[model samples]
Target: MAIPRLRPLLLVAVLLLRAFASLPTQAAARGGLDPSPGIADRKHGSSSRSLLQDQPEITEEMVRGYMSNFELESAIQDFGRRCANISRTYSIGKSVNGSPLWAIEISDKPGQREAEPAFKFIGNVHGDEPVGREVLMQLAYWLCDNYLKDPLAALIVENTHLHILPSMNPDGFALRRRGNANNVDLNRDFPDQFFPNNDDIKHRQPETRAIMNWIKQEHFTASASLHGGALVANYPWDGSRDTRKQYYGCPDDKTFRYMASLYSQSHYNMSLSKEFEGGITNGALWYPIYGGMQDWNYIHGGCFELTLEISDVKWPKASELLVIWKQNKMSMLNLVASLVKTGVHGRIFAADTGRPIPGSLMVKGIDSKINASGSFGDYHRILAPGQSYEVVASMEGYRPKRTRVMLGREATNLDFILDPDGAVRRTKPLRNDCGCSCNDNSNTGKPFLLREAYLWLYLLALFFLLALYLLFRRRMALRLAAHRHPPPKRPVAV
Candidate 1:
């Protein structure tokens, strides 16, 4: 009898098992093992990965190994050498203990800071959160190395300039403490409702002084402070007890959410969305913390800011360095993507007053989205545009102004004057077929809430994989059938 066909089937099964072994246990728990419907495990096993458990564990030896073994300076220098039209700048500032604070500015378009939206990425904001420093170095290197190879990296560098400060508090990092050399928490030093002015608290620290000056002079579009010790991406305006919390985000909730969502999607956590359920907060990941850099950036600098608590490790280990890099490397890219791609970039004004509209102004249309023209009647949206947009302008007492504009053409611009007459008791919100979470809640019937881009990408990838598998299976079957059935060798003899 011919050899059994079971051998080939067994070989295919082994190859599949090896492929799945590389995926983390958590992915298996979440039903991600099956790349396709035929291959997925039917029975459930407790194999899910915990968001909190994914980060590397820290220890004294791990810290020492990272410091002594890894030549960070060399890694950064090598990265800088790989890209064209990219240069690095070092901003030397003093730490609380008079130590040198090394900051790097990575840009493809030199001296074009004024033209592009400046973005600042600061790491090691808290001494215990040392992982930020590693991730940023990796980011700097990857960006430079991949600029020519990756279109996205090239586009980001060409359109937006990045200022990456790998270590904001060198002294604190060196000391391995949460506070600066003066033993004060740098995060708490920001001027807030609780702490006003540089007077009593006196924000005289060199790190703060240098960055504050840079932020004011450059007019950065957005910024993120990189820290570890937590797994969630925390956002600003934390002092508000309810919705009216004064210290919470600076008069623009829509802008904040647009940027925050970018960070959430690039990471592996969903708890980032549950702010009211204790998953999100201001001070905490998903919660707003008062006296934070994010609040200061919005209130003082007029920039959107986000805090990235990179990893769950208290003091991350050197071995976990690559893991952190994988988790965080895409966030800055996503940030750049949001700045370059999304948002409604315009100003709202009153029709009668000819003054910029102040208070809540909603811009909508067929897209089923709403862009809030903040207190200054200035709304810059990174939102999706569609065929037509219906805009409504409203203030506490001012009558609402309503109009429609088609946005399918070039950039859409609309200015309105509100009459003394009050409009119909506020119209319903906008809706769109696009899976944009900003203002449009359309497609709720679909049940699944995946992003439009993600859904499309998923479908494309699934189709490609299915085709490859079918081709391989067909080839194997043909080979097996040929072996099982003897060729018509006897025909010649007949």
Candidate 2:
């Protein structure tokens, strides 16, 4: 009995010793992932001190030249008035402090919806990160000042619908904090893909709710949000499924890597960063954070988003803001231009009626699928260049159409006309989202199926009613004959 007890203790001791021995190896195998406050002032690393309070405290003097909430609103109004022809300013929603979350729309036809790819630039996600807000205003001004004069500006304005929201959290900006007036971190407030513990959308903050609703309404092709305290473009899969700090990538990992590389290389010195390789890092590989906006946008919004840290310090001197804008100008312009300059864009249509079909799209190996707009049936897909991909367009009542194309540096146009598969036709109604029915012919599969089912039901009901009437008349006639002629004899059997 004593030997058996000793044997169990010995086994437990050996297991403990092995676990202790493997600890250093696991940390060391991570290579140069060691993060500390001294490496950089930015709060981006695995170091506890870096994560806690790496950023210095903001002073009123430091933020002297920055625009106040009132000043920013005035600047937006000024831009709209100055460039009313190609730009329209509207409020997406109101913030916690009742500040209007203003957005600028820059396009040839500002308010009209065309078969064009849409891109949005959201700035000042954290109140303390004010660099984005100022830089975005400068971007709006630049586009307005150089629309027809500059080739790049005209390409962006004529091709893509660029929406810019200069300040996402005015309340936080006023409070000089990371969180909003409610003291909630907006970056960590989005619905998490890995953790569904607090995934209730209704309970989210108002600022977050506005962004969610905006994404649902718009068919954005791709977007990027601005943040400070680092100089790297962080791409999707921000959190690992097992909650481990490792390089976990999404299905569109290759395309995301390409996009991140593009932005970094376009920047002045981002590509030459000593900390990040090629000045681009996977979100989870850098430092995993749950409920991040980057992962949510890619997973749910059908929009490719990147978290761009354009500065080394969170709260730099206000004078450096302009210099920072100049550094990131080309990167911003190139990103917006890439929406139309590169990618696969086309419309899906029905073979029979030649009408637009609101179909979903898929690439051969990618796991994600994007939807086309119901009105124009236009879809924009971003893929890595210099590659051949089989793009599939699928709808419920139509046979999917696939085409293989070798994509190049320039955008490719490949329209698909799918034949209606009557064998698999469903009763889904055809939506006329253009506010007016343009076709008088009621020959769509949806209406035809409904009418066919109704006709069968009507015929069946008529047959049953006729059979019941005949039976009633025959019984009435038998009663009448019985009444006319009296019964002579009746035999009772016991």
Worst 10 residues of 2 by lDDT: 23-32
lDDT of 1: 0.55
Residue 407's lDDT within candidate 1 is 44
Which whole-number lDDT from 0 to 100 does residue 161 have in model 1?
Answer: 70
Residue-by-residue lDDT tens digits, candidate 1, 284-315: 22322335567778666657777776776667
Distance (Å) between predicted and true CA of 187, model 1? 0.6
TM-score of each: 0.57, 0.76
Q: In model 1, how many backbone clashes occur? A: 32
Question: Any runs in candidate 1 off by more than 4 Å, and if so which?
Answer: 1-59, 67-84, 200-203, 241-250, 270-289, 345-494
Winning model by TM-score = 2
Q: List the residue pairs that clash in candidate 2.
A: none
State how far residue 195 of model 1 sits from its true place (Å). 3.7
Q: Write model 2 residue lDDT over 1-494, tens digit each, in one string.
A: 12343454446545544533332110000002322112322343452223236467788798899999999999999999999999999999988889999999999999998888899999998999999999999999999999989999998998889999999999999999988899888887888776662467666888998998899888888999998888999898876765555789999998899889999999999999998999998877776777778788888878999889998888789989989999999999998888877778877777556567789889989999999888778888888889988778889887776656777887777666566875344443322211111111223433222223434654565566556656666777788888899898888888
